[model samples]
Target: MHMIENGNVAAALGVRRCRVNVIAAYPITPQTPLTERLSEYVEAGEMKAEYIPVESEHSALAVCIAASSAGSRVFTATSANGLLYMHEQVQWASGARLPIVMCVVNRAVGAPWNVWNDQQDSISQRDTGWIQIYCSDHQQIIDTVIKAYWIAEKVSIPIMVCYDGYILSHTYMPFDLPDQDKVDAFLPPFKPDYALNPDEPASLNTVTLPDVRVDVRGELAHGYMEIRYLLQEELRKTLAVAAEAEKRFGDIFGREGDPYLESYRTSDADYIAVGLGSLTYQLRVSVDALRKEGIKVGILGVRFYRPFPDEAVASALKGKKAVIVFEKALSYGYEGALASDLKSALYEHLAGTGALPAVQNYILGIGGREIHTDHLTQALRAAIQGSISKEPVWIGLKL
Candidate 1:
């Protein structure tokens, strides 16, 4: 049954129809709509799932850990402080290697208690052993929510589907709803390899000493590295598995999926702007206007953040005059995280091939501030004119 709704409702219905066995949720701003929708689904018998309305975000994630430990397909959603509240369990979910999929609306954590757009909370857990996927639009959010299950289960890790607080989360957009049969075919039932079965009862998330540890820590660290490696490797794979999944999605539902990154008029440009999430969509509009004015500027919308598509990024940016990286979060005392990673990607290539372009980092759009077209237009013009200096630059601010 297809319906017109916001991204949050669409996501809730997608997971509900996927037949999730356990849902642990505590409502928070921007993400409450999803859980609210899931509640209605359960109440109306549209979904057959156990919806646990928790007292707090911490308890929500705790419930997820318990359900997942019992080998149920568990899911949750939160934003900002809610994610921060579940901080401990975030690591627990990954350390235990539970394929729990979460939707974290990118909101700013605050001393002033602001519930608006920002990337800090989710990005703060980058090292928590979860595969993070960013969505540029509502369609990507719905599609990635399904893809996240396959990716997480295949690699046996958690996945966080992040979208800007207001941009995609609150904005209403028309998106394709894949047929249930196609989704069922594409995403195999999430049968975990390890679980707490009564026939074969086992301890989970146990503490251990450094030397006397049961290799859980060692295996966890290794599993994290391997999962990340495979996640990147899967992006490079050109076989039927990934492609067939995307093709089946397209054939049944008519939604297209790109392998890694999306390019916009970069074929003959000397400069490129790299960004992720909804900002990239706005940047595309800015690029088009600049191009019309005879400005040779283009954009590369980064879809995958954690794996860091170094080779793909290098190939697209190679021979370009300069590359400008726009990031929503700051690493604190360092440049933007994406900018640093982009430089590192180029550095690896530079070491092997001895060729790379001048790159600069621009930090912008944190704490729910506005990012206008002129901001990008001026930044790109400065980058093209060689007026921008310093390794780390802050964009659209008095500084």
Candidate 2:
């Protein structure tokens, strides 16, 4: 069962020189191999780092938070329900502004017991204030990890490099591994804007009332609004920060990826299929097939999720006839989250500029259901052929 080109192993080795000084994780299906491989590399002396095997997912994140607070670059991996269990600490990591990088193998949350790919577990936490980057393939899985540190440390926020469980995580493909010297030159030691220093000795995570609090210079300020504004401004700047990181990564690696969104064949197409994660790969293949049949269909693959790339999406879908948002998770009572967010992003463009393209959302994959080429192709063809509604459309339903 040993595969020479497994994506998880390739990604682990690809970012091996990031110098992860600490790792704290608990084993979970589909994501277990990722941490396991890191442990192997550490034991084999490939990476000089401290590996902390924790008892539960909650403690896994707790350990990372402690290490990062002390100013050490940390790493971890988890999937499905494990990520759900770390939900509380997930917010704490971002609120404390520790730039830790973790690999999220996107999987379905279970009650009936399932181990499969779905974005629901992570997608539901879209408001966690961490930079969420979704990957389409194994190559991206590795490349994004290194870029994540650059982006996170630059903006002082955490990042989750998410890949579809089993799809990109377990698949095998040949990929390039960066040299250690180049990586060292690219990423330096962790220098936080602030850290938990014993000598400095400041209050960490102190609660605030509506009244007052002391600032660093002993000035009075509204702690709640001040911290909230700081978090918001820093989050808004993550888009540009990630873009700059991608530019630097490209300069060294000779491959450029837009941190927000990537458009394909949109300049001349009439319809665009907006997709994320592994589903974009299938959507691209189907779009090619649809093109061979003389249909003009393009693809817009969403890479960044948290800081939604409104401008990039608006630019790509400006002159299109219609846009079909292929969503992997539903927003429960509000239709597809990506679809609703995209609609909001395009409203200004439609009002300011010329007529914007028609937008329709389709919930395709949920609860670990399979999404194939025929399902995507047929739905796209239907939308292009007739008048599709602006509301969210559910694809591949059997009822």
Candidate 3:
């Protein structure tokens, strides 16, 4: 069915279609409406699920952890400080290898008390051992949420289906909602290898020692470090799993998916603009405008952030002259994290032959500050013309 609705509702419809058994919902700006729609579905008896209204984002995720541990398909949503509040459980959920999916409506964290759009919140949680897939629009929001569940269950790792707050969450756009029967066929019932049950009465995730130990059955068990290694290995392998899942999704839904990143006109371009979420799509205008003046520029929108697609990135940007990265967040004392990561990938894979591209970082749109296409175009032009700097470029600064 074709429909025009906000991103939150699109996400909610995706969750409902997947038949999530439990939703740990707490209201937070931008993310609040997603849960609000879930509540409406549960209240109207249109959706069959347990909608647990919690007092805090921490408790909301805690409920999801418990429900997911017991082998229920679970979901939760939050923004900015709300996500920071769940930091402890966030690591625990990933470490425990629970297949829980969450929607993080990207927002700026505050010391000055701002509630606006930025990638800082989720990007800061990069080391928390979760698969973070960023969406660029409402259609991608709905489609990615559906695939995240399958990928999480396949890898025994948690996943975050993230999109920008207000930009996509509050805005309405037309998208094709997949048929319920098709979604059901694509996502089967999740059956965990282990689930909490009265009959089983097994204790999971207990305190562990640094060294390997023998269990009650006299078999050697993994130590703390060894367990962490397995988690890292599975996340790396999830790249292939995600690709296969998306392939199956395309076969059924008729929309081919970009497994790691989406490239727009980078085939013969010498300069490529890279970014995440909806802002990257907005930069498409800059690419076109610059092309009119004989500047061959393209856009590279990163989709899967974690388990960073270094190989695919290196492949696309191998012969480029300059790679300009526009980010909504930074590394505190240094340039944008995405820019740094991109340079590392290019250097590690292609530096020996001297084919490395000049990577530039530009930080903008912090705390929902307006980002103009002309500002983006000017930045690209400056970087392409060798008028760049060592420090990260801060676009739209009046001071």
Candidate 4:
């Protein structure tokens, strides 16, 4: 079925197709419409799910946390400060190894209180043990929402299907609304590895000692450190599981692939531009312009941000002359997080093989600042001609 809809509604329709059992959310700018549509679906008896409209974003995710622990397919959405409000549970959900899928409509975290688009909100939460998948457009938003469920369930980790607020959330675009039958065929119902069942009363996520301990049943249980170690190991394995999920999704829906990195003309390019979310797709304009001028440049979208696609990034970027990275979020004093991580991956992957590419970092569009394609073209052009900066460049700054 072909339907033209905003990214929010696209996500709502995808969630409906997914047969999500529990939908809990609180309204925030750019993200409010996504949950509002879900609430309508639940109230109108169109979708058979519990839409719990909580008072605050914290409680919204807490509802998901509780519902997911009880073996329900749960979902929630938040942006900027709201996501920060649920920071504790953000860590808790993944630490508990619950397959809860969330849509993080990316927005700038407020200091002076602006309610516009940026990737900083989700970017800040990257260390919180959740698998973050950034989307480029409405199609990826809907498709990734469906695939997120499959991947999360396989790895038993929470996933943030992140996209820039307003940029993708409110923009109207045509995406194939996947058939309900195919979605049913692709995603199995949530059968948790363990849940809070009264019939089989068991202690879950209780206080742990420093080291390994024996439980009441004389079973060797993981301690605090051991549990953390297991989460780390499972997150690392998520890359492979996510790849398999993408393959199954492509086979069934035919709109999803390359779970880690989405490359645009990078095959025979010397300089590659890397970024996340819709900006990566927009950067292709610059790539095309540069190509016409006989400058070999390309765009690499880092899809799976957390678990950091070390090998995929290293493989895509190693042989390039310079990897120009543009980001919407900055890591305070340091460079853009994506740029820093890419450089680190290159260091490890190109240790003995070849010289590392000059990873030039540029921070732009923070707090809803306007990003122009020509700006990208000029930045890459400078890098290609060996005119670069060791420090991160802040684009469109007013001194």
User: Which regions in candidate 4 have their CA more than 4 angstroms from the true location?
Assistant: none
Per-model CA lDDT versus the true structure: 0.79, 0.84, 0.93, 0.91
Pairs in steric clash, model 1: none
lDDT of 1 at 277: 84
Best-performing candidate as measured by lDDT: 3
Ranking by TM-score: 3, 4, 2, 1
Residue pairs clashing, model 4? none
TM-score for candidate 1:
0.89
lDDT of 2: 0.84
- Superior candidate under lDDT, 1 versus 4: 4
lDDT accuracy of residue 140 in candidate 3: 98
Taking the tens digit of each residue's C-alpha lDDT, what string does model 4 give over 99-166? Answer: 98999999999897989999999999989999999999899999999999998998899999999999
What stretches of model 3 exceed 4 Å from their correct place? none
Q: List the candidates' TM-scores in order.
A: 0.89, 0.95, 0.99, 0.98
> lDDT tens string, model 1, 265-368?
99999889998788888898788888998988888887777656678888888878899888888788887778888888888776556467788788888787
Candidate 3 global lDDT: 0.93
